[model samples]
Target: MQQIIAAAIQFNVQQGDVEANLSHVRDALARVADRGAQLAVLPELWSTGFAYRTLTELAQRTDAVVAELQELSVRHNLVIVGSQPEPAGDNRVFNTIHVIDRGRIAATYRKLHLFSLLGEDTAFKGGERWCLAETSLGKIGVIICYDLRFPELSRRLALEGADLICVPAQWPKPRQEHWRTLLRARAIENQLPVVAANACGLIGKLDFFGMSMVIDHCGEVLADAGERPGEVLATLDRQAMTAWRAQIPCFADRRPDLY
Candidate 1:
C-alpha cells in the first residue's frame, strides 16, 4: 500500500469575510504543499467562520468558495476536504462539506447531525445521508463537526471500505474534551484512520478550541495541534491500515443483524 501525506489546517477564520478567509486558506495550502502534503483538511465553515447568524447571506457565496478551492487543489496537486454553509436547491441552507481531488469536486457531504443547542438548526438545514468519496489515496469519508459524536456513521463508512475519515469542525472550548475523546473512540472502534481539522479563536458567542489531530487505527494520536492556530502533517500508509484490519478482524466479526 502507498502512503500519502496529509495536512490539517487549524486557523482563526473571520466571519462573513470570504476574501480574507480565502487568502488565509491559500497560504495554508501553500505551506502544506511545501511540507509535501498531498491532501489537506480545513476547518468547518471556514469561509465564514461559524457565523450561523449570517448564514442566509453567506450561503449564497458557496459557489465562489468552491471555485477557489478547486483551483487550489489543482495547483497544489492536493485533495482538499472542507466545510461551508451552502444553499440547497430548495433555497434552504445546509452545512455542507466538499471533497476536492486534483482540481475536481469529488463529493459533497451535507452535515447530517446539526447542533441544535447552538441554534444551528435555526440557520442551517439538516442533511439526510452520508457520503464517501474516491481519491488517489483511497475511499475517504467526511463528516462535519457534531457528526463525530455518532459512532454508527463512522462504522457504516468503515464497513463500506473507507480507509480514513475526515472531520471538519468548529468545536467549542467547553466541549474540547468531548471532541478529543469522541475522535479517538471513533478511530479505535472503526479501526480506521481519522483526520480532523478544527478552527481556533472566538466567533460571536462561540469560542472554538482547535486541537486538530490525526489518529491511526490503534487509537494513537499520530499528530496533534494544540488549542492554537497551526497545522499538523502526517503520512497515511494504506499498507499499515490494511495490516491492522487483518489482524483485528473487527468488521468481519460484527453481527449486524443482532444489533
Candidate 2:
C-alpha cells in the first residue's frame, strides 16, 4: 500500500430515489477530489436504498449507475467503493459493491451475509464468494454492512495479502458502538488500514447514525465523520502500518493450525 489520501462519504439516503442519491454522491465526489482524495468509500446500497417493492426495476439501472461511477472515478482520479442493487436471476437482487479504480471496474463484490433481522435474506440473494480488488493504489478488501460482524471474512482477506479494507455500510442506530468498535478491531487485529463509510439521518422507519471512520493499523482514529451527512478525509501512511505490524507481529505469529 502506498501513502494515499482517502475519504468516506456519509449522507442521508433517501430510499428508492436514485437520481437524488446519485446527485449527492456526485457532489460529494467532486468535493473529495478537490480535497485530494485518491480513494473514496460510499455507503452500502447507496444508489437505491432497498426499495424492495421496486428493487427489480432499480436493479435494471445498475449498469448505467456503474458507468457513471466509472466516469466519475476517472474525472476525480479516485478509486470509488460503493454498493447498489444488482439484478439477479429469479427476480432477486444482490447487494453488490463496485470498486471503480480510475475509470476501470476493478472488482465487484456481492454481499455474503444478508441482514436477516431486516428480512434482507428474503429480499436479496446471498453471495457465495468474496472479493479483493487489486488496483494501482492497493489491494482493497471490501466488506458490506452485515459482513463486519463476521471476522472470518476479513481474516481471509488479510491472509490473502490485502493492504487495506473498505467497508461500505448502512449500519443504523442502537448498534452504533458495534459499528465503531468492529471497524477499529478489524484494523488492529489484521494490522491493516481501514476506511469505512456509513449512512446518516432518517431513512423510512429506520434512523441511521453516521460514524464513518478512517483508522490506522494501530487502531487509531484518523478521521471521524460524526453523526451527519458529510465527508471525512484522512491521509493513510503505509510505512506507519508496516512499522506497527513489525512492532506487534500479530500476523506473523498467527497460530492457524491451533485455531
Candidate 3:
C-alpha cells in the first residue's frame, strides 16, 4: 500500500512579528521532521499573524517567503504548505498559499473566499482560480480558512482528481465548532483525506482555537492537536482510499446532468 506521513503544526502566532513567527515555524518544521513526516503544514498567515491594521507593511513578497520555505524543504526533505499575505500589484494584496516540494515551489493557491466578518474582503483581493499541485505523495489541493466553509470548492477539487486537501487557517474561538465540523464534512463528502493546520492563542482581539487535525475519507479523526500548540502527525493510505472510492463510487454515480 502506498502511504504518506503528514503533519499539521499548531502554534501561537505573534501578531505583526514576521521574524518571531518565522522562527516559530522553523522550529515546528524541525519537530515534524523528527516525527518522520514527509509533508509539514503551517497555519494561515503564520509569518505575520492577523495584523490587518498593518497588513501592507507586514506583507512579504511571494518570492521571499517561497525562498525561505524552499531552503527549509530542502533541509528537511519534506513538502511544506502555508499561507501568507502578499502584495498583488496595483496596491492590492492577496492571501496566498504556497506549496514547496523538495526545495522547489510546486504550486500556489490564492484564497478565493474572503471572510467579510473580519473585513478580509476589504483588505485583500480574492483569487479567481483554484490550484492543485501534483507532488510525489499525491495530487494535493490548497485552500485557506474561509474557503473550508464552502463545500462546492472542495467538491470541485475532488472532481478534478485531488486525493488530498490542505487547509491553512486562523479560525477564531467563537466558530471553533464550525471549523471542526466543516473539516470532517469535506473529507467525508469528497472521500478524500484532509490535513488542516490552524493557528492557536490570541491575535489582536481574536482568540484562535488550535484544533489542527487530519481526517480520513471515512470521516474518522486520525489525529487531532486539540486546543494547544504542537504538531499532529498521521499517515494516509492511498491504497485504502482507492479501495474505498471503488466500493462507494460516489464520484462515478454523480448526476451532474440532473443537477
Model 3 score (lDDT): 0.89
Give TM per candidate.
0.97, 0.99, 0.97
Whole-model lDDT, candidate 2? 0.93
What are the Cα lDDT values of the candidates?
A: 0.88, 0.93, 0.89
RMSD of each: 1.2, 0.8, 1.2
Off by over 4 Å in 1: 89-91
Estimate, for each residue in 1-259, the C-alpha lDDT of model 2 and write its tens digit: 4698999999999899999999999999999999999999999999988788999899999999999999999999999999999989888999999999999999999999999999999989999898999998989999899999999999999989888999999998989999989999999889888999999999888899999999988889999999989999999998888888888888888888999
Model 2 CA lDDT for position 207? 90
The numbered model that scores best in TM-score is 2
Q: What is the lDDT of residue 125 in candidate 2?
A: 97
Q: Model 2 compared with the native: what TM-score?
A: 0.99
What are the per-model numbers of colliding residue pairs? 0, 0, 0
Query: Can you write out model 3's per-residue Cα lDDT over 2-51, one digit (the tens) per residue?
Result: 88898999999998888888888888898889889999889998888778
